[model samples]
Target: MPSEQPDGRGVPSPSQVDVVVGGIKGMLLDGTLGPGQRLPVEADLARALGVSRGPLREGVRALSHLGVLETRQGAGTYVTALDPALLLAPVSFLAELQQPASPALHEVRRLLETEAAALAARHAGPQALAAVQEALDAVAGPGAVDPQVFVEADVRFHRALAQASGNPVLAALVQAFAGPAVRARSRAAVGDEGALARTVQEHRAVLEAVRAGDPDRARRRMGAHLPAVEDPLAGAGEDPDAGPS
Candidate 1:
C-alpha cells in the first residue's frame, strides 16, 4: 500500500475510498466507462486511481448499492444501465423505514400525485388505462370488501396512475412515498365501512377524470382524493400534534 500523502503541494487528499469513487464517477461522466462496460482489472484500476485495492473494492461496493454498478460472478464489476427506476431503488427501502406513517410523506404524495394524475390524463395509453381500471375494480369488486383489499388496491391505483404518467422517475417517487404509509392506512381503514365506501367513490372520480383525458380535472380530482385518503392516517397514529415534518 502506498503511504497516504499530501498532493506534494501542501493540500491533503480525500480518503482513498473517496478517491476511488470519484475517479470512477469521473470516468463514468466523461464517457471513459459506459453502461454495461466492465471496469479495468483490479490491479490496473488501483494503480490508475492512486488508491489501494481495499479502498477500490469498498468504492465498488458502494456504487453497486447505489445502482451505479453491478458485479458479475467470475466476470468483474461493470457499470449498470443507469436507469432512473434502478437508481431510485433505495428511496423505496428508506420510505419503508418511516413505519406507522409520516404526515410529511402523505403531503409529498399529495403534491406529486396531483401532477402525476394530470400527466396520466395526458399520456396514458389503452393498456395503462386498463391496468388502472383493474386495480380500481379490485377495490370496488365483489360482495365482501376486505380492508386489506382497499389498501392493496389503493397502492396499486396510485402506482398505476404514476406509471401512466409516462415519467419513470415520478412513478418511482410516488411508489416509494406510498409504501411507508401502508400500516397506518390499513389501521384506519379496517372495520370502517364508511371509509371503505368513501375511498371507492373517490377513486372512481379520479379514474373518471383520468379516463376522460382531462388533465385539469384529473389533477383536481387527485388533489381532492389525497386529503380524504390521509384523513384516516392522522387518527391512526402518526402524531397529529407533531404536525407534518
Candidate 2:
C-alpha cells in the first residue's frame, strides 16, 4: 500500500476528495477525458491527481452516484454516455427524502408534460403515435385492473408521450418525474366514483387532441390530467412513501 503524505493522515477530508474531483473535471473540460472513455488505473490516476487512493475512490464514487461515471467489475471505471435521462435520474430520490416535495415535483412534471404533449402533437410520426397508443391501451386494459399494474402502465404512458415529443431533454426531465408520480398514484385511494375510469378518460382526451394534431388542446388535456395527481399528493402531505415501484 502507498503511504499518505504527512498532512494526509486519518480519514480523508473534503479537500482531499476535491483534489481528485477537480483534477478529473479539469481533464474533462480540456477533453483529456470524455464520455465512454476508460479511466486510467487507480495508482496512475492518483499519481496524476496528486491525491491518495482513498480520496480518489471517494471522488470516483461521488461521480458515479451523479451518473457521470460507471465502474464495471474487473473492467474498471469509465465515463458514462452522459445521456440526459441518466444524469437526471437521481432527481427521483428527492421525493423519497422530502415527501413534502411531491407536489412541487408534480408541478414541474405538469409543466414539462403539457409542453411535451403539444410538441408531440406537432412532431409525432405514425410509429411514435402508435407507441403511445399502445402504452395508453395497456393502462386502460385488463391487467391494469390491479393497482400495481395500473401504476406501471400509467408510467409507461407518460414515458411514451414524452418520447413522442421529439425533445430529448424534455423527455428525460419527464422520465425523472416518474418516481414521484408513481409514489403518489400507488398511495391514492381509488373509488367507484370513477377515479381509474376518469384517469383513462383523461388519457384518451389527450390522445384525441394529439391525433387531431391540435397542439393547444393536447396541452390543455395534459395540463388537466396532471393536476389531479397534484391534489392527492398534496393531501397526503409528507406521508410515508409506500416505496417507489
Candidate 3:
C-alpha cells in the first residue's frame, strides 16, 4: 500500500517513478543539479522527493541509461558530462531501426549535413581536415571495391565532416542518421559498377570545397551529394512489387 500523509495526500506515492523522475529533471533544469555533480544520497533524495527508495532508484537507473546520469562503483551516482554524442546514443539506435530510411529522416539528414559541411569548411582545422581526407582516401583506395569497406569508409568520411563542423550536437545528429544512410547506399551499390565511383567522386568534391575553406561551395556540394546517394531508393517505401520508374 502507498504511504499517506496527514493532509489526505499520498506520500511517496501517486506514480512514484514519474514523481522521482520529474523531481530530478526539475532539479537539473533549475541548476540544482549540474553536470558531473553527485546526486544527493539515495535515502535523502527519496525522502526529499517524497518517494519510496524503489522508485527513486529505478528513476535514477533510467536516467543513467539515457546518458543524463552516471553511476560509479562505491562512488555514488553523478550527473554525466552531458556530451551530445553520449546523450544521443539511444537516439542513434532508434534511427538505425527505421530501415531503408524515411523521407522525414532523409530530410533531417540533408538539412543537418548541409549545414555541417558549411561549418566544417569555415572552422575545421588542419587535423580535422586531415581526418576527413583520410576517410575519403580510404574510400578510393585498393579495397574500395569491397562493399563493406567502401560503406565503412563512406560513413567515416561523413562522421569526420560532422566533427569538423565544431558542433558536437550536430556531429551526434549526423551520426544518428548514419546507420540508415549507410544501408541505403549499400543497397544501391550492390551490382552497380558506377555507384561506388560516383560516391567517391562526390565525396571528393565536397572535401575539396571544405579544404578550400569555401563554405558556400561546401554546402552546395553536400546538398547535391546526398540526393545522388538517396535517389536510387526513391520508391523504396512504396509497393514492394512496383516496377522501377
lDDT of 1 at 81: 89
Give per-residue CA lDDT, model 2, range 1-245, as digits (tens): 12343444666445778787778889889999999999999999999999889989999998898898999999999999988888887765665565654557777887889999999999999999998898778767653377766677778888898999999989988887765675576457354335676668778888888889999888877776776675543322221123211
Deviating ranges (above 4 Å) for candidate 1:
1-12, 233-245
lDDT of 1 by residue, 1-245 (tens): 23457787978767788888899999998999999899999999999999889989998998998999999999999999898878988988887777655777777878889899999999999999999999889968657777677778888988998999999999988888876564466567786766676667777878889889998888877776676556663332222124332
Best candidate, lDDT: 3
Q: List the residue pairs that clash in candidate 3.
A: none
The 0-to-1 C-alpha lDDT of every candidate, in the order given, reads 0.80, 0.78, 0.83
lDDT of 2: 0.78
What's each prediction's clash count? 0, 0, 0
All candidates in order of TM-score, best leading: 1, 3, 2
For each candidate, give its TM-score against the true structure: 0.85, 0.79, 0.85
Query: What is the TM-score of candidate 2?
Result: 0.79
**1 or 2, which is superior by lDDT?**
1
